[model samples]
Target: MAADTTPPALQDFLTWRLHRLAKLTDRQSSDAYTQVFALGVGEARCLAAIGQFAPLSVKDLAAQANLDKAQASRAAQMLVDRELVLKSASETDARGVVLTLTRSGRPLWKRVMRLIEQRNADIFGCLTKAEQRQLEAVFDRLIAHADARPQGSSPATP
Candidate 1:
């Protein structure tokens, strides 16, 4: 038989579907953050990460916030400029700095966290509790598998 010649639809790709879902959720989250806190998603993410994992270096902040180093650095600087975050030189790493929320930032941090919790609830509300649990487990496994794979590796053959 001749090889198949049909073009694949976008929906046929799992990665595309996941990207579309991420875009939808990210847009919603960005709008919510802007409306309630006048903050960008990057800033909010940085604030949440710093609040939850204080004394983090810029490198650690990038990892915790799921952001690249440049984005984390810019957000950290903005927070520092707003007096919401204090950046101090790290004692352990001479070239690195640690980030911590200021007293005023603490209240904002709480608000951000509450907003995040609400958003998560709203987004996943369509799913039953058991389905949500199953989805979470599936996501965890997928993330672990992705992490275990080497970057730029070829996809496994069927």
Candidate 2:
């Protein structure tokens, strides 16, 4: 009967490392968005989602932007208030509302897309083309595996 001497290190955790990377890139993107577009990260994401996939409902935008419904709704409202996006009645669902970029927002959306391209290049520039392709494949597989798992289910013990 003895207490365990070994302890887990934060650096050894894959999730923590991934989160750190995500935070770093997200911070950089957030700063860029705020400085260039005067937008919060959520607002920028909502705008991008609406621009890329017009006629989206709040729920659809949330999924597209990887945001919660509440966050998406709030961002959509802000975009609507700023006249960057138009909110209209959904054609399929009478009670549901659809979101689309406004005429003024088109140019902004193009700029945003360019900024995204630049940011991607800046972030992944260190990796070789082969490495980038491998990384993308690995990420796709991991995402697919995670998506296939049932919610709230714990991983099996190694």
Candidate 3:
């Protein structure tokens, strides 16, 4: 048979498209946060997670922020160095610690949250309300499916 001339449909791949979207979204947020708060993406995520879920452990922040333990720890330390988050021993777990926004951090968190809301609206503005809802539902399903899979398992495998 003659050599196949068709190009790979990367644009049509769900994973590829989602990855592209994520990168775009992250870059936009990163730029905005850095401009306003002098924070990198990981640091901003950790800050937001801590602000939104105060009195939570670092492990919980890592899980909520979708960051690994090391990354989360680094971010937490940075936040502490900046005095934006307060770290203290966990009341429930003697060996564990919890994080919460400092007085200064609360106002910053509010501003960041407002910016995020605007950014999300701008990003999803192209879609209709129904389409947005549909997309969110689909994303929920995709997230659940991916999260339920065994780590390192090939998608093509059982």
Candidate 4:
């Protein structure tokens, strides 16, 4: 049989679909964070990273949150201004400061964790446990492939 020549629809593209889902989820989570905790998405990312892994430096938090250093620093400072995080001089590294959730931030972090769990359930609860595991494995492989690409090589460009 002759090959079909029809172009794939935009919605049928995996990359486009993945990006659509990401944007939708990000918007939903961002709205909830802003309404409930007065945190923007960037700030929420930083806060969540620090809350999950205390004593992290701005550099480490940036890496964990997949944000640039400047954005991470700004988010960290915002959290500091709100008293949600305590930035203290690192005992091991005098040049660096460690970030940890404040007494008030702990409860907020718990709330954020609950929100995240609920969001995951809402998005993926339809998938069976086996299907979820398969999806996770595919995601891991995609992440590894993306990570292995050379910097500045745009996936969208030839």
Candidate 5:
């Protein structure tokens, strides 16, 4: 289906939401930088993706995290050096490697999840039931639009 390009209001709303999310993400990353690996935003994202999808290969992990192969590979190595993740050669493909969290990272992962959950609750807690419903509907619509768009195209143009 063709996107409804005529809805200027929808475009505006999406743009505003994107900016708001960016700001929120920046704040979170900066606040946690000293505590974490002084990692930039992308590194934090890589860590979360690894936590969520452990035992994934570098290529798969990059795709899951919306990162490029180089970035993901670098992050994976960094995580291994930090003793947060483990990397082992894939049994199925000798050239491929899979990454997973190490034993020591369990507590840190849990702490990060709790902190993020609290922030999410704080951000959306003020919305009423109806508002929450509307927000979900809007988010769904945005995702549909995104899915319909071509790959390699970003919503936030640089």
Candidate 6:
């Protein structure tokens, strides 16, 4: 048995796993929405965020998406151009706009959500309910850890 102490191995593992999960989910959704739209994951994500929590400002959307505000603003503009989303000048603030999923967006929202639910169910079916809960608890712990860290630091690396 050779030395097995690898520094930052856990950190590297966590980063790889996180990115892998994102890629897998995006691939599935890419297949799900294959022919109906011309949106990339970023665009679809912005739409999904607005679809779930509409009437939010671009700033709020950025916070929710963990995206740059300028990027969110541009994504929202593209969505608007496609008529998949609607944005209105804010009544409360002169420098803000509020966004909502449009009528044409309703079906797309439903479709994406259905795909998400199905994939979630499929993934969860591999474990017992208790195991599922444990997995979720582990994820919650990591989330709390990330929440507590300084903006750009990772626990295992820091």
Give the winner by TM-score.
1
Candidate numbers sorted by TM-score from highest down = 1, 2, 3, 4, 6, 5
**Number of backbone-clashing residue pairs for each candidate, in the order shown:** 0, 0, 0, 0, 0, 0
Q: So what's the TM-score on candidate 4? A: 0.83
Q: 1-158 in candidate 6: lDDT tens per residue?
A: 89877677654787788888777877876665554566765677788789899888999999776679988999889889989889999999998999999999878877767766777787578899899999999999998987888997755854
Candidate 5: list runs displaced more than 4 Å. 1-13, 36-39, 152-158
| Residues 1-158 of candidate 2: C-alpha lDDT, one tens digit per residue | 99998989988999999999999999999999999999988999999989999889999999999899999999999999999999999989989999999999889988998998899999999999999999999999999999999989997897
Q: In terms of lDDT, which candidate is stronger, 4 or 5?
A: 4
lDDT of each: 0.96, 0.94, 0.91, 0.91, 0.77, 0.82
Provide the TM-score for each candidate, comma-separated: 0.93, 0.92, 0.88, 0.83, 0.72, 0.76
- Collision count of model 2: 0
Encode model 4's per-residue lDDT on 1-158: one tens digit a residue: 98998998999999899999999999998998899888998998888899998889999999998799999999999999999999999998989999999999888888888888888888899999899999999999999999899988975854
- For residues 128-148, write the lDDT of model 1, one tens digit per residue: 999999999999999999999
What is candidate 3's lDDT per residue for 82-135, written digit by digit as tens? Answer: 999999999899999999999998888888888888899999999999999999
Model 3 pairs in collision: none
Mark the 10 consecutive residues where model 3 has the least summed lDDT: 149-158
Question: How well does candidate 5 score on lDDT at residue 114?
Answer: 66
Query: What lDDT does model 3 reach?
Result: 0.91
Clashing pairs in 2: none
lDDT per residue as tens, model 5, 42-124: 55666777788888898988887778999888877887888888889899998999888888866666766666676667677
Cα lDDT of candidate 6 equals: 0.82
lDDT for 126 (candidate 6): 82
The candidate that wins on lDDT is 1
Total backbone clashes of model 5?
A: 0
Candidate 1: minimum summed lDDT over ten consecutive residues — where? 149-158
Off by over 4 Å in 3: 1-7, 156-158
